[model samples]
Target: MSEPARDDASRGYRDHPRSKPGPGSITRRLRRHRPHYLTAAAVAFALVVAGVSAGVQSGAPVDSAAAAATPSGTAAASPLTAVPASPAPAASGAGRAASPKATPPPATAAAPKAGKVPAAVAPAAAHKPAKVPAAAARKPAAVPAAAAVAAPAISPELDGQIGAIIAANSAYALGVSLIDLSDGVVHGYGVQGNFVAASTAKILAASAYYHLVETGRASLAAPMGGTTAGDQIRQMVQQSNNNSWALILSAVGYWGIAAYAASIGITYDCTVNLLTPEEMARTLELLYAGRLLSARHTAQLLSYMQNTNFETLIPPAVPPGIEVFHKYGLLYGNLHDASILVKGSRAFVFVVYTRGLSESDMGPRTRIIQKLTRTVTGALF
Candidate 1:
C-alpha cells in the first residue's frame, strides 16, 4: 500500500503498544483522525509563522542616540528636553563627539575668570549689556555728570533782607515767591502757603480760554455770555469785573481750572478759588516761557495785566519807566499781588500774598505793600 502510516518522533505524536492497539488497529484510528490532525497542524503552522514575524519586528535595531536627540521626531530637536535615570551609552558617546567643537567660544569669553586677561577685557566687558548687573548700571556716563552740576548760589545778604522785612511785618502773614528768570535763583520766605485767589482766579479763566482757543476747541470770535471772547477777557483781567469772570468760569467750568492747576503742580481749592503764591509765580513763568499760550496770546494777556486798574502795590514801587505785567486780588482782609516785572532785558516773577491784616485802613495796607515791594526790588535789582 502506500508505505504504511508514518509517524514523526520529533513532533508530539507517539506509537501505541501492540497489546492495546496494534499497528494495524492504530493505523485505522489514525486514518479516521488524520483529517482532524491535518486541520490542527495547519492552525499551528499559521500561529508559528505569525510569532516569527512579530519577533522579527520587535528585535529590529534602534538608534537610541538619534531618538534622544529628536524624541518628538522633529529635525531640529533639544537634547535637554528630558534626562534619563542613567546615561545612555550611545548618547554619551555621541556627546563626546560634539564636545571639542562646542567648547572654545565660552572658554575664550570666560578668560577674565583666570585674572590674567582682566584689564584688557574689562573695558570691553564693561560696555556689554549682557553682563550688566541692573538697569541703573546701563545709564550713560553723562547722566550723572549732568545731575552732579551744582545749582547757582543765592546770596546770604538777600536772605537777610527778606528775613528782616518779614520779621518787621509781624501783624500780617506774608508769602512771597520770587524767581529771577535770568539765573533761575528762587528766593521766597512763605511761598508754599495758600491764600484767597479773589480776582486772580480771573487770570486762570483767561488762561483757560486762551488754552482752549489755541487747541482749536474754542475760538476768540465765539460769542461767550452774549459777548466776544476778546471783550470778556479784557473786562475780566483789566477791570477785574465779576460779571466777566462769572461768564468765563461758566464757559470753562470749575473742573477746567482744576485741570490747569494740576498740570502745573499747583494745589487748587475748587470751592473758594484758593491757591499758593508759588503757583501764581509759576503761572506767570509759564506765560513768559511761551508754554501756556502762543506768543501773540501771551502778549495780549500781558497787555491786559499791564493796564489792570488795581496798581497800588507793585507798579508804584517799580521804576516808573519799567513795564509791569501784574494782577492783584483783594478779598475781605486778604491782599495778593503777582507780577512779571521787566526792566530792560531782565525779567523776574514776583508774587506776594498778605492775609490777617485789615483792609479797612487802605492807606497803611497800601503803603506796607509798597514798602515791601521796594525792599524786595532794591535787594534783588
Candidate 2:
C-alpha cells in the first residue's frame, strides 16, 4: 500500500503534458448502466419480431435467421432452408399420412368421366326434334278435297253415251241440252248453234208475263179479256195452242220477250226467233231454281207442262207415272222436244232439237230421240 499509494499519488500529481486519460472510469460507468442497455436491446428485438410477423402475414419474403429460430417461428422455414438434417422420419411419416388422405380426393375428382356417357346418348334424344316437323308435314294431304270440289259434276259415262248418240245420228243437225240438277252437271251437244226455239218461245212469253206481274205492271189473277192470265198461260203451255200463243205474243210483243230473256242471261236471235239449247237449258234451270217467277206463277207454268199431248221423246223412256213436263215442236221438217223429267224430288231437263231426218216423218226422229233418252238415262241413273 505504501509503494502503490506513493506511485498513485505520484501519478495523480502532474504527469507528462502529452499523456492521455485512461478508460477505466468509462468502463465502470458502463457496468453501472448495463440494465438500461438490456432493456433497449429487448425492445429492439420485440419491434423486429413484430415487423417480421407483419411481413409474414402480408405474404412478404422474410430473411431473418434469428426470427426464424424464435419460439414464435414463421412460415419462412422452407425445405431448402431450415430443415433438420436427421430425426426427419416423423415429418416424413406425417407427409405420407397427408398424401394418402389426399389420394382419394383425386380419385373422386375423376367423376366427370361419367358425364360423358350422357353426352354419347344425347344424339338419340335430339331425334325427337325431327319428329315435330313430320306432324307439320302432314297438312298437304288434304289437297285432294280441294280437287274434289273443283271436279266436273257431269258423269263421264253419261257424257259418253250422249256423245255417241249424236255421232251416230248424222242425218239431222241435232242440238241437245241435258242438265242433272242433282249434281249440277250440264251435258250440252251442239247447244251453241242457233236453232229455232219453236214452242220454247212460249216459255219466254210466260216469263215475260210473270216478270210484268213481279214488277206490279200486271197481275196473274187478273183477266186479260174473257179469262184470267192463268187460263191463257195454261192453254198456251199445255195444248201448244197456236192461237193462244199468238194472242200472248201480240200482247207481250217480240221485244218484251227478248228483254225478259236478256234479263235472265239468255241469248236470243230476234230475227229468226231462235234460242240455243244452252240458253233454253239455262232458262229452265233458272225457272226450277225459282229465279224467273214467283212460286204461284212457277207452279202454274210447270203444272201446265205436266200433261202434254206428245209423249214420243223423253216421256216414254222415263219411269211410268212420273211427271213428264214437256213441249214438242213440228215445223218445216224440224222436230224438237224440251222436257223436265221429275222423279221423287229430283228434276232434270233435256232439250233436243233435230232437223233433216231421212224419214220425212215424225216416227223415225221420235224413235231416235227415244232411244237416245233411254241410253242417257240408263247410263246416268
Candidate 3:
C-alpha cells in the first residue's frame, strides 16, 4: 500500500518549520552538516574551559583537589577565599556555560573576606586538620629524574689541538678517523677522498707472498744465493729497502698482488701501486681482527712488518714503549706518506701522505703529521 509523504512542518519545533526544505536543498544539507557542527562546537568549548583553568606547563586544569592533599587525611580548618578572577579562556571565543539558580554558599565555602567584593571562589581546603600545621608553602611538584644521560660532549680544547696539528703538518695529506670498531662508530673524515699509500702497499704484497710461501707454491726459505729469499723479505720490510720489494714483487708475480689483495678484502686498484686511505685502513683493521689469516699467520705477519727502524716517521710521535706495526715508502715523485698499523684493544689505522712538496716544504708538514698522530692516539688510548 502507498502512503502520503509526511511534511517537514508536521515535525516538532526541532525541525524548524520556517526553514522547511526541498529534498535536494536545505534538508539534505542540514542532515549532512548538523552533526559535524555540533561535534566541532563541543570540542571548541572543551578547549576553552580547559584553557581557562590550565597550568602553563601542563595545560591540565588546575587540580585543586590533588594540590589540596596533605600527609594527614583530616579536613583543614579553613577554606581560604581567594580572588574570583580567573585566567581567560581560549582566545577563540566564549563557550556556553551552565546557568544555575543563585543560592547562598554553604558554611564550608565561607572564608576570609578582603576589601569589599562579591562572592569569591574559595581555595581548596587542605587534608590535614587544624591540630597539624600545613606545609609552609605548597610544595613544588616532585621533579622526576631525567631518563636519558647525555654523554660528555667532545671538548673544544681537543678540536683546537687537532686544528693546530693539522696546520703544522702540511707535508703529508695527514688526517684521522675516530671509530668505535665494535659498534661501527665513525668519527672524523672517514669515507672521504684517497690518501697516498706509500709503503703500505707492501703490506698487501707481503700478505700475498707469504700466503704463497705457506702453501709451498712459493718458498720463503728457498736460497737465491747464500741468503734465503724469505730472509731477504724480512730484511726489506724491516729496512724499507727497494731491492727487497723488487724481489718480492717478482716472486708474487704481477697478477699475484691483485689476486691476494682481493682475497684479503682490499678491493681498490691493486693493479698499480696506488691505494686510498680507506682501503689501507680497512686492510689494517681486517688484519687486526685476524680475518686476513689464521692467528698464527697474522702474528707472524705483524712481527715481520713491525720492525720500525726504517719506519722512522711515526715511531717518534708515539711513546717509547708502545708497539706499532707500520711501513714507510719514499718515492722520488712525491713526499713520503707513512701508513701506521696500530694493534691491541684500542686498534687504529693511520695514514699521513704528503704531496706537492719538496724536502724544504715537507719539514713542517711531516712534523705536524707526527704531532697530531701522537696526540690522537694518546687521547683515544
Candidate 4:
C-alpha cells in the first residue's frame, strides 16, 4: 500500500530532526501559535468591553447587557432584560461610541390646541402657604365710630338775661317778647302779662278796617266818622291821630276788632285797651309774614308804620341799615312799643310794654325799653 505525503507546514509545525512527536511536541506547537490565540482573546475581551460601554452610553442598564449575553432563556425573562434599551447614537466616524455621561436632549411639553386655553398648573408644594390658627382666622377687624353732629345755635341764656333786666327795672311793671326769625326761637320774660295797649291798639283797628276792605264788606274810600276810612287809617298809623283812630275803630266796631283778633288766633280786649306782649309780637309776626294782609296792603301798612310821630322806644335803639316798622302807645301810666326790625333777609318782632309811670313822665320806662332793645340786638346779631 502507498502512504500519502503530509505537509508539516499546514500542520503548523515543520518537521525537524530535533523535534519528536510527544507531549513536548504539543508544547512546541502551542508555543508556535501563541500570538494568534492571544490576538483572538484580546479581540473578544475588547468586544465585551465595547458592549458594556454601549449599554451604559445608550442609557440601558449595564446588567441588561449582561443578561442579553447570557445563554439561558431564563435571562430573557429576567426583570433586567425586560427593560427597554435606549436608542443608539449615530456612529461618528468609523467606530466612535457616545460618551457615558452625555446629557440627553430635554423632553418638550405638548402645545395646546388653537382656540383652547391650557389648564393652570397647581402651585408647587414648596410654595404653598401654611394653615392659619382657628382663633386668628375667626377674629373680626375693628371698625371706627361715627362722628358726632353739632347742636343748633339756640340761646336759652337769653331768657335769664331778660329776667335780670326786668329785675333791674323793679319799679315799673315790664313785659317783653322777641322773636328770632333766623332760628324761629322766641325769647322773653313776662310775655303773657296784660298791659295797657294804648294807641298800639290802633294797629288792631287798622287791621280790622283793612280786613273789611279785603272781604268786600267795607270800602277804603267810603266816609266813616267824618273822613274816608283810608285817610283815617293812614292818619291813625302814621301820625297817631286819636280822632282818626276813633273814626276807624267806630267804622270797624269793637265786635269787629274782637272777631278779627279771634280769627288771627289772639285775645284782645279792645274796650279796656289791654293786650299781652306775646299777643302784640304775634300780631306783628303775622303782619311781617304776610299772613294777616295781602302783599300790597302789607307794604302799604308797613310804609305807614315807618318814621311815625313816636320814635322813642325800639326804632331809636336799632342799628343803622336795619328798617324799623313800629308803633308806640301812651296812656295814664302805660308805655309800650311794638316793632318789626329788618336787615337784609332777616327780621324779628319785638314788643315792649311797661306801666306804673305817669303819661307825662315816660322817660325812665322808655329808656329801659331802649336798653333792653340794645341788649337783644347785641345778643343776636
- Cα lDDT for residue 211, model 3? 82
> What Cα-based lDDT does every candidate model obtain?
0.64, 0.61, 0.52, 0.68
Query: Candidate 3: where is the Cα deviation over 4 Å?
Result: 1-164, 167-172, 175-192, 267-271, 333-344
Candidate No. with top lDDT: 4
Q: How do the residues 1-381 of candidate 2 rate in per-residue lDDT, one tens digit apiece?
A: 122335666567766756755769678878999999999999999999999889789996555674557445554333434433222111111011101110011111111111121111101121112133766567665533323232232355556666677778766777887775544344676434767777777787877887888898777688665887767777888888777777676666778777877887776654577877766776775565455765556656776666576666777887563456677776776788887654443456778888764336677778778987787656544
For each candidate in turn, the TM-score is 0.58, 0.57, 0.53, 0.59
State in Å the error of residue 167, model 3: 5.4
Tell me the TM-score of model 2.
Answer: 0.57
Candidate 1: how many backbone clashes? 0
Better of 3 and 4 by TM-score: 4
Ordering by TM-score: 4, 1, 2, 3
Give a tens-digit lDDT track for model 1, residues 103-148. 1111111112121212211112211223446675677655423343
Candidate 2: Cα lDDT at 46: 100
Q: Model 3 over residues 18-109: C-alpha lDDT tens digits?
A: 77766689777889999999999999999988777574657544545634663233333233222222322111111111112112222232
The local lDDT score (0 to 100) that residue 159 gets in candidate 4 is 53
Clashes of 4: 0
Which parts of model 4 are misplaced by more than 4 Å? 1-154, 182-185
C-alpha lDDT of candidate 2 relative to the true structure = 0.61
lDDT of 4 by residue, 116-158 (tens): 2212111121112335589966776353111111122224455
